[model samples]
Target: MDSPATLEHYKAGMLLSGAGDSTGFKRELNYSGPDIHEAKKQLGGLKNITVKLPDWSVSDDTDLHLATAEALATGKKGEELLQEVALHYVEGMKDMTGREPGGSTIMGASMLKPGTEGGYRIPYNPESGGCGAAMRTMFIGLSPATLEHYKAGMLLSGAGDAIGFKWEFNYSGPDIHEAVKQLGGLKNITVKLPDWSVSDDTVLHLATAEALATGKKGEELLQEVAFRYVEGMKDMTGREPGGSTIMGASMLKPGTEGGYRIPYNPRSGGCGAAMRTMCIGLRYPRPEQLSSLVAVAVETGRMTHPHPTGFLGGLASALFTAYAVQRRPITEWGLGLVKEACPAAKEFVKTAGYAVEETERDWGYFTEKWEWYLELRGLSSGTGPVVWPDPYGPAERDKAYESFSWSGWGGSSGHDAPMIALDALLGAGSNWEELMNRVAFHGGDSDSTAVIACCCWGLLYGTEGVPPGNYSNLEYRDRLENSAEELYKLSH
Candidate 1:
């Protein structure tokens, strides 16, 4: 594993670079000719002068640092690096307060303009050797290999979800039978047993991968792709899709006026929403893009779960997954990101007619309840007691489960399942087997929680960390691998 300190140092260095730029510009303001000095002198020799500071924001140096970091994280190199940096550079300029960048930085960035015919060349300006470029190169010192490893880890997570679903819940429904029939008979299956089959989670993930591969923007495209998958599932199996799929399929049905905005069941808050959000998180690379990411996640969730809790559950899952894939220190920043994304989640929930008072209280209560549950589970941070003395042995777990649902099926609720999955991931530490075991055996929607938890485990540790036995028996193993590869390609 790469040292967290090293990542933190690079982050701190970038911030320091920005601070240096701010200080340098501010100091220069202090020496703005004798006329300014005279004007200050006329103000009664005020030694303690308060001047309105310039924006004091980071400059193109920080901009280049961020862009380069993203490029490196996504495995861009040579011409790819140049193109990515060029695009990010323009985006950085547009993001700037006044749409201006340092002349040298702009010149170097402009060399890789769109439609420019270039094989591969260093984007440097001989005329300009400003400190901007040199100072921001600290991030480049971090190994690209580490980022690649993280990507592999994320893909493995997707695999874990799909395969884990198969291993734990075998095929019992018409959906599984149809899938098996479509892919030759059980006799043709070599690695997979007849009973092993994937769920809507994997199907929806592949749907997302196909959509992203076509270069479509997230929101509408992802939702459409998800609906198509749901519709396909409905067509294949002459049964109403269970859990959140029922609501999603209903919403996707042609409405009274030839539209797709049919009202869905707001009461549905199943784990399905969170289970399928990993693909969305993998597509968008930055936190600044969180709003759009959350938007798409909500739309995807709206297919089945229009409730605020449902949307927030999906958003939270994607945020955590994205942060994990980016190699953010989970123990340090995971909970913080969840908290940061909560306001947006609440607002999304509010749109579902969740009372304002209830929205605020629910989020606050959920956080508190989650923390309390973690404490009870003997988890201090992202690591904890490896083997929880069977949760069923103690009445406390039963009571907690009942608090969420009367049927002891807490994992059926979108909010509850994600919380449980997050808890499982945090407490599992590096023990992938333990994570899988705990989630799979937790009972009541265990399959859903297993998928979510296993996905998180994969994000933290690559496929190498997962036991081969877990995925080897999956019927759609090849498809899962292909989907993961496609998602990885598009993400990069």
Candidate 2:
């Protein structure tokens, strides 16, 4: 066997690896065979090759390799070492102008955290079979290894809740823009408290999340969720909790002989149910968990808003969250969701002994709403150039939403809450600022709509574009992150 590698050997290996990367990048050598032979033959002999600095640049793989080496040189261990490596990898993304970084590498690096256990590596991704990992890790013989999207979803949902909650009581309609101007313009809005305290939306969402994180399933999970909802009501000071939710939770009897769910209430169709169900999707995100998602979402929804319109909105939010976590196309996120999940939702209503007749009758209301939304966005025909339209101004938004049969009160009811939120998400594309402007500064129940929208956005794009001040000091941030981490562990 050969002798162990010395300092000079390591140096030589790193330099050569970087040089190889630069040469391969410059040659555009992703594949091999006669094509490479022809290109090399056309270039003549090695005497003509003049690989120099600045001109022949290495790819992001080499940059990340250097980062990894620096991380290893820090003399840290365990979580500290992992944190150092994550920081270096993320910082390396700043100046990758022509580096040709792998998309998976960027995504994985963007999501790395600092302290939590098992937070070093990203979760399994079947499609991430790129050479980025191998190229960057060539120098290291051994090392360590996330559901970062779900975690971001959880955290940013609270951020959206806080910001939107501030606007709920402060501004309405066209005046919200002026309010935004008063708060040092849109970009200057600090996401810290007491200006941006999270309301009942996040509290109830956390209750659902913490309950799901307990790893209970079926009736046990539902019971725990109901218990938490009831318990959550005790600390509603300054939360501005909704009356519908308060009344609904007050009547719940968890661990009782019958069940934790209340009877179907035709009168209740508020946004309360939809706002808190984002965590349900995070808990059950796999294709196999569709039934579980349907059950949990519908059951938890019925716990408060038992009407089909209300409960179905909860199902929609959860389903959309799952779709976002799966990285499904944004265009498909709206109409495709209604097509896919409606059947499962209907089946759950029938088998779960809900008011089947009422659900069958009122379910069309929710379905038609989505269909109308798709039609409005020019997504219903499937033949047209389907682009998620730009976000409408407040007046235009409310004017269009008036046709949804909700008296122009956008996002007031459960059906329209998730709908408006989804519209914001689609329109905003990858822009966090645009997402907040569309969903959080809207007319009715902005906080409720924002909670769902931000969760889906976070799942699709892990808070990369969101300003740090927006979420760094968000209330209950620790609880939200921990809850997300637990749910991510369960899902992954």
Candidate 3:
């Protein structure tokens, strides 16, 4: 290893700053997160380690301890023969996301296939909600390398959800490809958008409108537009923030017991709003609007979540992401950003001593007990009808929140959801072996968490789809390209 100096390898580039306290607004905050400096030290020792490729692993030397172990394998860096792992990534989950199977939610999984004509198709079914929109948003960072492209990306991801499939398959399904074609805004293109691609009327039209209005309103453009567009999520069925959204955060109104400066999260928090955060790059200026994302998203959280922890949960997620990419592997890094970002996220949650799991996967188990913790233990029924219940005070018998609740965590939903998302990306580990150890036991929404895991894994790999069996999904290629393009534009 070399000296202990720190090196920040960003995907594109991002600023790391401590978001200011509830006071004067500071445009650019450079916060590296707690223990981040120490994390850098661990990274220093990492260079000395050599990653051995498995005979069959997704990313060399699969983190075999946890996951079921994929058949794919990778080779040494700089080797001309390193297996193309990113390709299969998009392949495995495409069709699984359809309404019939994957249906109506990003929390569902989809399968990807390669073919002629249009390279990709929705294959599975259409899903609604900001989570699907957000998870599929990788392309957003790709095509849109500028303000203009960012708008287009947002339109496609968010607005696409307005449509409904099933029963009216032809009208709804066929239009999905058309929506992508238009929202991709790739006019006069011989490359037809192909067929079978799933999209929604809400995301399509809303994104289209945003594309048109981008830059028209100056700085606050994205904030206003994305906020407007995200409202579409309010209509998506089965979508609601879990109660853990406010379980243990500081900002819990006042007299909060057990050490709460604030309840950190509010009951209204869900993967939905954070999913909407991806499109934000298109709407807001970084470093500048970053804090606003935390602040305004909180107001939005209050809509359904009476608890502040829910708000903090979303806030922490976005902030950590905007901050943690500073250390992604540029030379030969692991797909650890998801892992790093989640724990780093606790810096915000720590305000409430919300309890950060040993790792992101542990959150899976903690989440299992989530609803049990909230309704039975956290929420007290005595005080009737709290719009936003503060989980502080004497473990209270009050209900400043019972009536105004958005929805319950239902235990089942939260448990499986995050992990499914994890599997979707599959990058939880430094290698395949590690990936398994981290994801397989993931509680609650196994399928959905896997979906997200795969998606996040795909993020580390950028536009590359998972290899062989899944890669050539033509439709996947197109959408992946489109999504990446959109994200690229927003970064600048």
Highest lDDT scorer: 2
Give the lDDT ranking, best first: 2, 1, 3
Off by over 4 Å in 1: 1-191, 235-241, 253-261, 332-334, 347-407
1 or 2, greater by lDDT: 2
> lDDT of model 3 at residue 149?
32
Quote each prediction's TM-score: 0.57, 0.70, 0.33
Q: Write down the TM-score for model 2.
A: 0.70
| C-alpha lDDT score of every prediction, in listed order | 0.56, 0.80, 0.29
Among residues 3 or more apart in sequence or in different chains, the pairs in candidate 1 whose N, CA or C atoms overlap within 3 Å are 248-303, 248-304, 269-414, 308-349
Q: Could you tell me how far off, in angstroms, the CA of residue 136 lies in candidate 3 after the best superposition?
A: 39
Over 196-288, each residue of candidate 1 has an lDDT whose tens digit, in order, gives 455566556555556655666644575456556555555424221355665466556432332333354545556667666766766664666
RMSD of 1: 13.6
Q: Give candidate 3 misplaced runs (Cα > 4 Å).
A: 1-78, 81-267, 279-293, 296-306, 328-427, 430-443, 446-452, 463-483
Query: Which candidate leads the pack in TM-score?
Result: 2
Candidate 3, residues 1-492, lDDT tens digits: the string is: 121112241222211111111110110133654455455456574343233323111210011100111212232232111122223334334433211222333232233232323323335443354333332223223221233233233322221121111111222212333443464422222221232222222232233234323433322442343344444444434323233322321233312232112222323334433333333323333444443444433333333332433333333323323322222222111122223333333343343233333222234433333233224322223121222224322112112111112242211232223322322222233342233223222222122222223333433333222222122332234443454454444444
For model 2, how does the per-residue alpha-carbon lDDT over 1-492 read when each residue is reduced to its tens digit? 122244566688899998888877875644766777677677785556667878788888789999988998887877788888888888888859899898898888777764667668888889889988788777566321136777789999999898888778643657786788787866676788777788899999999999999999888999999999999898788988876788789889989944677776787788888999998888877666788899999899989888878888888888888777665556676665687777888888889876888778777778888888788777775333454435568777756555553656778787888878877877788898888878888667778889999999888888787878889888899999999999988976
In Å, residue 189's CA in model 1 sits off its true spot by 15
